[model samples]
Target: MESTSPLFALRNVTKVFPGVRALDDVRLELYPGQVTALVGENGAGKSTLVKTMTGIYQPESGEIWYDGQQVTIRNPEDARQMGITAIHQETVLFDDMTVAENIFAGSYLTRGRFGNLDWKAMNRRAQEILHDIEAPLSPTAMLSGLSIGQKHMVAIARALSVDARVVILDEPTAALSHHEIHELYELVRRLKARGTAIMFITHKFDEIFAIADRYTVFRDGAFVGDGRIEDVTEPELVEMMVARSLNETYPKVEAPLGEEVFRAEGFSHPTEFADISFAVRKGEILGFYGLVGAGRTEIMRALIGLSEQARGEIYIEGQRVSVRSPADAVQAGLVYVPEERQQQGVMLDMPIYQNISLPQLHRTSRAGFLSTRNELAVARQYGERLNVKTSSWSELVNNLSGGNQQKVVIAKWLATHPRVIIMDEPTKGIDIGSKAAVHAFMSELVQQGLAVIMVSSELPEIMGMADRMIVMNEGRQVREFTRDEATAEAIVSAATGVRA
Candidate 1:
């Protein structure tokens, strides 16, 4: 096998699973001393290619070449030993372990004839790596105590510990604050400066353009295009990924606004948000705009009864209601679609029909036993309405792709027949097509007199979909804007406390 003249390359890769071809004839290349971005919508085979490179999956037909030579990656360890490493969105660090321990988890330093663990040497090296990455933390600090950004740095340190020549970062800044994301960018630059081939994957085009040197696009499990970042525009890249120009990303519909349907007066969560007051009218989508730590999510959680100490008076249709738990809120005709679908929205192992019917099992059951026919009917109705792509209503929620899984979550909430639906980061990790679908569905729901309270960090969503928006900062509602008055500049300024 001759060296391919690139640090790493995947040629003509194909992977198949039951009822799906995850990757088909995908080609990708990573060059030393440069960052190559993998741009694609969810379920577009970007993840599959990364998995193949990391030894999680063997391609049906493909060749993985490293430093111009063909190689077989038997397992994760084999990939790591070959200098191909990945730092995923979720940091794989033990919470109970020290930073140094996490950095040198599987492979540890040893000394002496008996080969005893070398804690001092390991800690010193960990400190050096942390400093190199501009991470401010003690190597002896527990991983649990550090913030999400710091945990990511620990993952990077682990990659450094292995002397990784090729590094793949999958949505690394998904949970990072603006400042932390800039720090991560600097760290990536340092890695690239050291001649490490970097593969960056993210849904954010701004970040991709800012940091990536080259870009490769994939669509529907097939390679689309690859070229220098300077040679492609954002709109062009988006078209390549979704097979359509997203001229209207939001697809917000104009509907006649009705009387106030849901209102929260003096809503307060002791340590999270304070004095949050807002009213959402029927057929209107009230947007909540804020920065990462501005307590937008906490307010929604409180309204949905997730916060026990949430002090507030919630009124639906002029009558005050006491919401002490999720069930209480749902019974009040107010349902919440949580941001983390896998953790709070749906049960992955459960069938789609069951998940859809779980919230309203009492309505679909007779004498405490769930009526399978009723459940199926309800799931089928909402599934079609949301245009959820699935093998069948009996399929497990986890079997669906990220975008379809999100639709399932939305479908389950819609099945509850709530008058007021609160969505938190509704399209956080979904693809452009699914996002458009969800946005369109939201428009349809509001047009049908279903009031929606949408909490979002994406400015474009806030600007495009929101009829009116309330900006929060440090637990307080600072500013409110109607659709005509709201601008990205104004919203960001309010969210960051730069303007009052």
Candidate 2:
């Protein structure tokens, strides 16, 4: 395979940060019309390799090959010109711009004579691209008004508009629904039929097996293995991801749930959620399963007092509690780990110690002065417990990998010792190895008598970890399932309000 000529290839790519060697002696090949699935643990140098190939990062030592010819891509424009384009894990679209405007952003269509913007032609072209992808969205619609799945489709449309020969999709289905994911698969098939090579990066093994023709596994900044998708079992892939056999990924522990630790009654928030009610006991994990607009996040936000217009009765430890703000919720022994980790969870520019200690500043301060010793001690403790990969606690959070950054966020909350924790899409963009680590941590937390309310889109995670599950549909709790009773079909039916 290595001897065969590839349409696109990365030869011995290496990237280094201050103390971190992000990628080391890595190599990959993307054959024409083949979808290669990139798999690894978070921080396994997957992002670094992609960034290097896409011109977000210049490799310290390596060569990129296009059609058996060596090339150096210095910027995104250069990569695009060379028929390389990447759709990031996070959708990068202008919220204020229309779909057509965003699709043709830097290179807008111009009319004859004067260089006037050709709005009609641009919209028509955008509509044509969307039609090709089978996406149900208007070209004139504002990006902010679209769902996460819709935003993802728009990104794909943008990539297709460039007529890219090699398309890289990073965690494309992290926020998409089953129907939308099917649409994406169809689009990928069409692209492949047209002889376009694809590099797909995802944590979902099911999707990988479904769409990928070949697979590559990365571990700790190095390539471990690559082969045909049919040649590998799910367990084998899992072992390759973590570099070890995982005995039990979920590792459920039985703990007697105590009286209700947190309760919401008649919770209502306009446009977000309404008429939601549930109770979570100590030493229990209450998993919430829903589609993108099923009001899972809105309910969690209301519980943490992030929604101003939220109206409800919240009881903590059987005592009525009123949370008017985030501070109020924190004072009441409740904390929220937001879905957008970069925007809300941690301060990227700050050091790990500072970010970890931010949530509990008052505890680490003496008479309004922060105690550096206390901060460092706390950060080091949680960092080690979470297995955060870093040279030191003084390292910046942004410098760490996606999974390590997530650990820092969890460590920040754990430092505060909240009784009830609401986690929104905790493992959304993380790799399978880090995801298992997080699942283990959650199980441990519940065993230690902490109550957890987890909102997730992945059915397997919910079924495996939750003691009880609640399915939401369009802001309503349509069904509930015990750990023994929940199945993929049942959960999907409940979430989509579809009878089965």
Query: Highest lDDT among the candidates is held by which one?
Result: 1
Instruction: Kindly list the per-residue Cα lDDT of model 1 for residues 330-437, writing each as its tens digit.
Output: 899999989989998899999999998888788899998889999999999999888888778999998787789888888988888899999999998787878888
lDDT of 1 at 280: 93
Error of 2 at 32 (Å): 1.5
Tens digits of per-residue lDDT for model 2 on 253-314? 77789888999999998787879999999999999999888989988988888888889999
RMSD of 1: 2.2
> Model 2: clashing residue pairs?
none
Off by over 4 Å in 1: 1-5
**Clash numbers, per candidate:** 2, 0
